[model samples]
Target chain A: MSVGASINARGLTKSYGSGEGAFHALGPIDLDIKPGEFVSLIGPSGCGKSTTMLLVSGLEPPSAGSIAIDGRPLTKPITEIGIVFQDHLLLEFRTAMKNVLLQQEIRGLDRAESRQRAEHLFARLGLVGAEDRYPWQLSGGMRQRVSIARALVHDPSMLLMDEPFGALDAISRTQIRHDLEMLWLETRKTVLFITHSIDEAIGLSDRVFVMSRSPGRIVDEIKIDLPRPRPAHLGEYPDFAAYTKRIYSVFEKLGVYKFD
Target chain B: MSDQIAPVTSPPTPAARLIRAGWLWSILNSVLSVVIFLALWEGLIRLFDVPVWLVPKPSDFLGRFLVDYPEILRNALATSVTLAAGFGLGVVIAVPLALLMVSIGALERGLYPVIVFLNIMPKTVIGPILIIWFGVSPLVSVLVVFLMCFFPVLVDSMHGFRAVDPRLDYITRSMGATPWQAFRYVRLPASMSHIFAGMRIGIVKAVEGVIIAEFIGSSAGLGFMIMRASSFMNMELLFCGLVAVAIVALIFNALLATSERIMMPWVRPR
Candidate 1:
């Protein structure tokens, strides 16, 4: 099965509040994501990367403009989109396997098949022995992995991850990043990953979309032409530093960083 | 490699052992205290040659209870039935009211202050009024119990529902869970401890409510037996009636604790 979905946004805009109090969070922006592509959205805080993901996932409607997924207008419920957040957000009362099965429950999938799928996903995520453990019993990294397993349990074509590893320690963050990259490579799902770390975006993304603050819009798009099966040691490469330097320059030009 | 993995065996701490022994020690202490008090009373009665009608010795009370055990048991059953009916009714009424309070902000704002005022009012004063309206029937007694028990359950459930983590709601919504699903999976399960806490208090109040209603009007329950014994200065029978009430309350509370344990095995009692 082809695990990809084309996403289109034309003049997408989102605002909070009304009239005098209205604050624009995003465009009037246009973008396109080809199927099976890994895209990372990088920007300063309040640049609306998170808001853009929310709009694209059909959790919230765009204030203006249009969004389409797989050539269908994204007006109704978009069941094919998977979303993960900064917080693990696992239900503390449920076991890891049960939490993963929640996607099947919400999507109205058959019980026996969903449970089998959940077990397979848990095994693939290296949580085979810990399926019955509750969220509170697991470490932070383990809990976040459970969240990922839950997001992918239904085999969603598009995965929207907003700072999914932000709460992990440095070591766990690196490990999860490697795991995520391998998962992406194997599944070839269209991924929209949002993060603040330029290194993470450069390390994982096929393309990076950088945004400007205060009425957010995509200000720069950088293609990472690094080889497939990128090594963890690629961060040490001169080319990786060059890409980081270019993205940092965009941030500098946007006045997102102040030296004085 | 052997040093890398330590064996995970440790003896129970002194604190854990103490906690394990705590309940037995408390029960023994309580028994000792009651025994000493009863011995003192018996000695006083024997030495002073007081009339049995004035103040019954422990033996006298126990003897009367044993002789009329069947009658006492029957009356106790009547009281227990009334308590169950009233408490069940109160819980049924309060839970929906609490859910309504969570769903409708305007309704909550309008009703909460009035509920607080009603809760603080002297509920005992309404006992006579209920008797007059429903005429010493089981319905009147049950209604009284319901009135006494309803407010605490309502207030606690409302607080519990309101206390559901907003982040969890966001998670549920993002997962495409409907409003009912959010309530069933997130809000209701999250509020389990609070609801049970309310029920624990409400059960006690329900027992008290039934006794008070019976004391005011009815002639069948332990409350009625106590009233009659007090009027005739039969202190032994009165003490027996009081003991029956205490035992009923104890049993009800124990059942509530057991049910809570079953429902929320994950929650540890502090």
Candidate 2:
């Protein structure tokens, strides 16, 4: 928590449509993520978790307030960050390796250098021999791994993951969570991960921001005390009871204790 | 044709099974079907003692087809040339127009109704209008085929271009990809399958368009040959000409199928 703020946002707010149909999509809340920190945003379906990620990534502008990344204002579209979306969104015609190289093409970086980096990343990410395979040929987990490789291929400082494992089966999700922990431990990049599951948020992050729905805003910020090399099964860990209990307590404050 | 495509990573089990049935089986199947159909027709015609001016006996049709084979080949060549020209031009022009229509709202608004209205009008009506403007020539035949081929390709390409997942564009743009880069890398490649769908239907329309043109106006193609046969009540020759037309269409379809396979190796041929 002592590290300098990697991403600083003050009074950040996003809304859609004019009066009557006007909808508050996101916050007017202050946020500060420390350097090399992993933070998860947990909220209901309409809680604007994705909108916050988009606003920070410069994909959308906040109606009021600003976001600054590493002390640099994100007033325009920038490539200093990478995002692994909920959907892998891999081009079907392309091979896994070529899809990773897509980051290079977008960044206007050297192809040979990016290919070498992609090879290393793919291998490190457990995609060694599957580089030649198309997205359809690979399993859902593999596609998500390829997407992770793509996000890192450009060597961006920050990674914004919008529930990248949300679509995967339980086994794949648990498996990838371990792999992601390994990835983060090695790279130590600033990350903002968004998910609906309280277990996922507490299982992965150093900090968890519980959000409320409708007029979405951060309602609680819990510094996760779960130890590193996180427990594979949240149910198996003794500390999970305390973390889950606390996250549910936040939800209960809104009169909603659903665990979906 | 599918074999010429790169070995797809996902094995297409059903398509592979169909292919394993082999060329010999396919040929025999078609030959058997054709024989049964011709035999039934021949039996009915002979039993009825139908006039030669009506449906001629298959044997008599074959004999006359052999005699007129040289003329049939020449007419086939003329029609094929015009059809190919029109179809090729239609592909080159319509696809770009389709892209323009999808990319620009103003163009879509101004030209869409005109395009739809033109497509709705009977192609036969367009043939005479083309003749009136350009005179009785091969150009009219080519123009008619082009017109027929145009709408399908335009519609299909537009569909393909818009068919790109909006998320793909969002991801590309969020990654700082310029509009042109997004179009080149994501939009265009994603649209290939749809564009090819258009080409498949467009090629068939091209065949019909060229024939209709020749039938109505031109005097140097298979359609003209049909006219000549009908005028003389040469039922065998007319049937032979019709057979030639069908063969030509089969060739076009085969050619298009191969091109589709070559261009879009990811798409399993159905």
Candidate 3:
């Protein structure tokens, strides 16, 4: 029971608008994520990866499906899940320390312990001097790292990130990806990550779920059998390249070769 | 493979360059503008031999203002007190009212239009009515300032709260924050810059409202002094009263700018 919680979503679907303009954003599909596994959902735009993330995080209810975490039905937002959006979304008035402690305030948890934990998390995220810095005072990369720190401060069992590094430059993107990989290795929390980049999916995920567009659903699932504590540069490895090629081939089938 | 790393010195942005305009230059430009305006005023008065009764020379106005400084200061203080009281009350009331309006769609439908209707009426009509009700007491001046400040704040707060990033609001909900906690911790701070901007406008309006109230009913503020001096044909005193009003406006503005800087240090004070 104390192990990282797994997600089981059955017949999950999401539809927007009404009548003639009705749009099915996500699937009548089934998905399962095992405990302590790192799963990546990679797809083209409008493949409903974000919609799927929202459903599992319990922020949005499915049109006709059920999502249970560790065999328990999740009706609303539970404390065991942490989510990071694309933007930092830090309160400009608050410091990084205060922003991280916002989770504690929401849950009415112990302040002193939460503050101690927040500081520890910040240090772990390489934000050693940023605890007192306001969001504007930090650079874009630093701000993004602070956002990651805020999400992980509560120490949730499951972490859902929707393209957290999507907004960064090439250099920062590579750097943050390395940081994320190391963090995941140390924590081994059940992570469900969404990204549009095939390389990011193949580089970080143990299991990658490739989705199809136009009433989005999972089309293919690939497991990267690369060894744990893997090499720093994923592209240098032949097996990583093989995994990436297969995922891109799925995109060609779906006619999403634009970015490939 | 080459081990050499490239230097990462990025070019400065245009906005960063614009902010490099020094404070000394800013102050010098302002002072030069005032000097030129005073020179023109002095030249016109002396050349036209304008009657002191109709348009007192700048020299005459300055001298008389200095002589009547004590009386002017008293009236200015009285007017400022009213403005402060009203401005404080306006923010306290309007922020909560706006929170109520934005949080519940039904209440917004029921009450927002009525609020708009009340705000649309020119305070000129409302001033006399308020004076009639409160009757020459200091309370009349306070009420008018409150009325002048109330609408802008209510409208601005409503806009700010409603315009908060929905994604950020979703974060609060997912974090298990109560609605009140969300408003206090997230929505209110998110809209702080807008709220302060509204308060600046409210401060200016509060000053105008108090003067109007004083002119219409009371006999204890700069507006009342202006009226009294004009009726008696003491042109210098009238000029002095007007100067007092200008000084008060500047003081109020400076105070607000200072507080804005203190509260939102992220926004470099302009």
* Tens-digit per-residue lDDT, B1-270, candidate 1: 001111222324434543543444545665688789889989999999888888778888988877999989999999999898999999999988999988899999999899999899978788888877888788878888998889989989988888877767656766678988888877887888898889988998888889988888787888888898899887988999998998788677766766665566444334
Name model 3 segments beyond 4 Å from true: A1-3, A258-260, B1-48, B63-67, B115-117, B268-270
Using lDDT as the measure, which candidate wins?
2
- Would you list the C-alpha lDDT of every candidate in the order shown? 0.82, 0.83, 0.82
The top-ranked prediction according to TM-score is 2
Which pairs in model 3 have colliding backbones? Answer: none
Highest DockQ: which candidate? 2
For candidate 2, write residues B1-270 as lDDT tens digits: 001113355545534534544343455676788799889989999899988776778888878767878999999999999999999999999988998999999999999999999889877787878878988899999999998989999999999998888878667876789888998888888999889889999998899888889988897889989988888887889999888898788778767765665555665334
List model 2 lDDT by residue over A12-96, tens digit each: 9999997999988888878899888999998888788998988888888889998898898888866767789899989998888
Evaluated at residue A192, the lDDT of candidate 2 is 94
Interface RMSD of 3: 6.7
Better of 2 and 3 by lDDT: 2
What is the descending lDDT order? 2, 1, 3
- Misplaced by over 4 Å in model 1 are B1-57, B173-176, B268-270
